[model samples]
Target: MNPVKTIQRLWLLFLLQIPFALMAQHPVRLAVAGITHGHSDWIYNRKLRGDIEIAGIYETNADRVQEFRKRYQLPENLFYTNLEQLLDKVKPEGVMAFGPVNEHIAVVRACAPRKINVMVEKPLATTYKDAQEIADLAKRYGIKVLTDFETSWYASNQYVRNSYKEGRLGQLRKVMINDGHEGPWAMNRHFVSWLTDPVKNGGGALMDFGCYGANLMTWLMEGQRPLSVTAVTHQNRPDRYPKVEDEATIILQYPEAQCVIQASWSWSFSRKDMEVYGTKGYAIAADPVKIRTRMQGASSEVSQTLEPRSAPFNDPFAVFANVIRGTLKLEPDDVYELPVNVTVVEILDAARTSAKSGKTIYLKPRPALVQAGNVGNN
Candidate 1:
């Protein structure tokens, strides 16, 4: 046996095994802060799959707490009635929020001082003000704050990005995004009330689904601010959702391109899909599972049933687990990052204002509060 060659080979093997070793050694300890929103399924279901172990869960709604307890078969003690109590007892490594869009800040505030990382369902919060607080706390505590989106896990979206970068998708022109469903009520009536309330959930479909289009367009534009935003919103089902608009159409104008964000709660069925049109080609992300691409003057087209990119990008559970072990770092500009979500909220705010004013509104990127480490130009 050659000692020198054997030593080099052994070192290579060890280097290759490092990541797997770290992954197997310990799983991330997580706790859920709220289970009221229907989106909580994103977190709790993962626990059911044994994908992630939630050390604790919390909710003040007795009915919801009992319902989730019955569904998950969680022990009485595994569910806490208070946020601080859950954190104090379990001392989990991180917390994943599944509460109302409005409570994102309170959840982060509770977890920040403890140095626990947090990931909330998309939009970051109900307003830009809350997002600002989230960023400040993240900077002060030096903990990761993530906003997860089901779009971030789609291969079709990634394929479009890859094509554009490779010069195959051609010069970007317009992005059309339609995201929503028949309504939150079609999913769960109890959750629908807060979801439809302007105060608790912001502004119906515009608030709930508008963030998706904004986040996608922001990422597609490489964080460019829109010249102006024009929007119209209305309640197609005012009898059912009198407090908020159930549908909205927002147009965002960029220097070289434009985007149409169609967010609605009045669709015949559930939807969260997009289409990208460029001078030389076009791509359609039909739901998350399918993608079709056509190139100008090409002999044929390409289609894909895209698989998830990898861990972290694959799902929220995978991402947070790696984050806890210090393996994955969230980019400041990443869709899940604070700055990106702030822009999302900002756009939603403008959309709402535009809807109410019945006019176009200009948008400027607000200088990030914690801009010290912003990635693109910092």
Candidate 2:
């Protein structure tokens, strides 16, 4: 072959390889630790979709492992009796920690030393100190840690967020969120083991549901941590949840705005609604998938329904994969940012304190200098 023709053929082959190289760059391998949360369904769905390969599962109890395998149709080979064995063998790209709140710290501690990224289920930790320790370890090792606040990543919520950013709501004034379900009785039996235990679950209805409201409030308000929190929780169903409170209301005060969040485990109504009020207009997310807005003097209300794209786990998992692949950059203030999860823990802690004392509890201010660049590296 002529030298010029051969050189041209080699160049053409190199150009063709670019797309395949990008595709092979980062393939996410996920191992799930402690599948006790009911939301494990999302993770199971992701595994089925081929978005993430299920490297293994770590569960302490044999019976629970059997139940998980049977319920989710997970292969027997994927179950690891011990977490350490699972971590060492799987060497997964990341771990999904959906264990009980009391067990959260220990799981994170175990994974942190291995420099493994973790996506933990929220109420980040059982206590403020434990949460801080996890945060400190994450920082020390430079690992990406995320809490599973799936609603914050919902496209409908994104629409509302965009409206807020565009000043469609004008100056923010107040935000109200109501996320109440039937009760723990309606929840899966697995949740009963830990969720009703204040020692295990951290707090009652407020900690379980109010965290969503608090997270959304902070997320939409541009990462303004709550200045103070006041809350009241009642044991409406002492017969069912004898040890835990079944109803709760929390008020969070911010410097520029205030938010009222109500959650009830014993409520008759099934509602997940949020209304954000601003100087010029108001926006409401009637459900997790719809955003509706009304501006002053507007002839018609603006409405948007999010088209189904990826499931909750798939969306975050894809983002996490990109981060690991160095294609997506994670900002400090982003809700998925690890430090923000730490802040969420602090706010929930303050809320618990307020609920117990029956008084507004003040929170320590976040450091001024640590801005958007200081979060987990993507």
Candidate 3:
């Protein structure tokens, strides 16, 4: 055979094998910590795509365990009643949490001791104290901890973040985010008991929807601590959400800029979007996949579409894989880090407190009642 023909045939064979090579590479070993939260579907869909292996799963509630198992048609053998047993047996490299937001600390505490990484659904924890404890554990164990925001994966959100970071919008002036939907009851979510429990879900819409604004604001401000936060939460349907607030508004006051976060479960329609106004222009994450921009003096808005992010930054599994392999370095000031999450949790906590006390809670010391304070006192 001619040498050129021989070389071409070999190259063709290699090309044919590349697809299998890529498919088998970078598969992350993962486990599930809770399935009660509706967000479990996000990770489950990733599992279907073979991005991560569901090494094991545990839930305190047997019914929940079985319900999820049957719902997803997961293998019965994968369920473990005890968390420790699952960890000891499967020994996954990471854990994805889908339980109540308040359970984050306890689950992280368990996984950290084994040097296993963890990814929790947004808001980090129900309180700042829990956030701190999880931070300490992650530090001691030398494991990565990430708080997964549905918005974090949004290309439009990143577009806004990069726009401000690059000073494309000039000096930052204000951030206005409106995120939420019609009531969960209206949608008939199956596992909403915890989502409506003030202790478990952590302040209803202010927590469920408000955290998106807090997380994005923290990232945009470059982790600058706010002077104070003022907020108000209301329960429009007291009979339905007697224990929690269904609608809430939080304001974060910085040195030169302010952010208004409106989160609610009571709305005319569903919405999860944001608007960022700077000194010279403004950008809006009109939706998850679209961005609309307007210059200061422009007569019309310029709309652009954003392509979804690629692997490592695209999904939890890919990101977790890069994290365990030491390829992705999440800075302490990064929005996903514990310190940032702590502040986010603190802001939410203060929002609830402000609603109860009807005062602007200053972060410097305590909520010293002031006659003229006006941030969250409204």
Candidate 4:
């Protein structure tokens, strides 16, 4: 072979290998703040994509840590019992909170100051106050704080949202979201403990599953605060979940539209679905990929199987890595954005108040704390 041709082929090969080399050498460093959350195993169970690296994990429970070590065959040096020590040592780009809902505040407080982003499961916090504080910390530190919801990545939901945004659904008149499972008891015992505790997980079904509706509605409304909130809660399973209500129905009245959220832990089957009605048409998201819709001219509802969302939007960890690496920008009312999740906590707060007082609770305004946080610009 000619030496010049050989040298040129080698140079081309080296150029093609550069991207793969960078992916292997500099995967996004991610830390786990807690391990008790049932969904915490997502990070370990996911097939390696070479885009994320588990830098460190901080869990107070040694047994849980051991269980994770044995299950995933992770090294002992990757675990830390103390949060601050882990943060200081690994200095990961982001931290995912897998503890109780109430613990989100502490995770944000620690990660924000360190200039590390955070992603927590579902509701941003147990209360509006904690949510506001997390938003404030994110704003102050210029870090991204995201809430992960399994429904957010649903292709059906995304299809509906896109159609609505494109004026195909017309003005949204009513939206109904149903989300829940049989109960937390059937899941991990540790998850059930905090999930049932009123203080740790907020109200039972209302906060656990209700947040899904609130989060989705807030996103559909473009982060607008509702006019008033009314809710009714019941302890259908008093024998099992005595400390908190097992079922809840929350109504949100807007100036031009309304929403009904049915959240229950007593469902015979697990489900996460939504029905959206507009002035000119309607769309029902029956599952992650199936949707039924009827437009004005359509004779009847039509069903469709939607394609899954593309990368960075399909996975929560992918989103965190993209945001931290400055490859993806979030919208003001993105389902996972801090502002939208903050409003979700606010709605839950009002729902709790309404349920207890048996009166409709009129929202005064978006709290000044939330407004001042500059969460939308993120």
- Residue by residue across 107-154, what tens digits does model 3's lDDT show? 888898898888899889998778767766776677777888878778
Model 4 poorest ten-residue lDDT run: 369-378
Q: Give one digit per residue, the lDDT tens place, for model 1 in 173-228.
A: 98999898887766665588688889778889898899999998887776667889
Between candidates 2 and 4, which one is better according to lDDT? 4
Superposed model 1: Cα runs more than 4 Å off:
1-23, 47-51, 299-301, 370-378
Q: Give the TM-score of candidate 3.
A: 0.87
**lDDT score for candidate 3 against the true structure:** 0.80
Which number leads on TM-score?
4
Candidate closest to the true structure, highest lDDT: 4
Looking at model 3, residue 162 earns an lDDT score of: 85
Steric clash pairs (candidate 4):
none
Whole-structure CA lDDT of model 1: 0.82
Q: Between candidates 1 and 3, name the one with more favorable lDDT.
A: 1
The lowest-lDDT stretch of 10 consecutive residues in candidate 3 is 369-378
RMSD of each: 3.9, 2.8, 7.3, 3.3
Query: Which of 1 and 3 is the better model by TM-score?
Result: 1
Q: Which ranges of candidate 4 are over 4 A from the true structure?
A: 1-25, 367-373, 376-378
Q: Give the Å error, residue 268, model 4.
A: 0.7
Clashing pairs in 2: none
Task: For residues 229-289, write the lDDT of model 4, one tens digit per residue.
Answer: 9999999989999899999999999999999999999999999999999988999999999
At residue 113, give the lDDT of candidate 2: 85
Which residues of candidate 2, in runs, are more than 4 Å off? 1-26, 308-314, 366-371
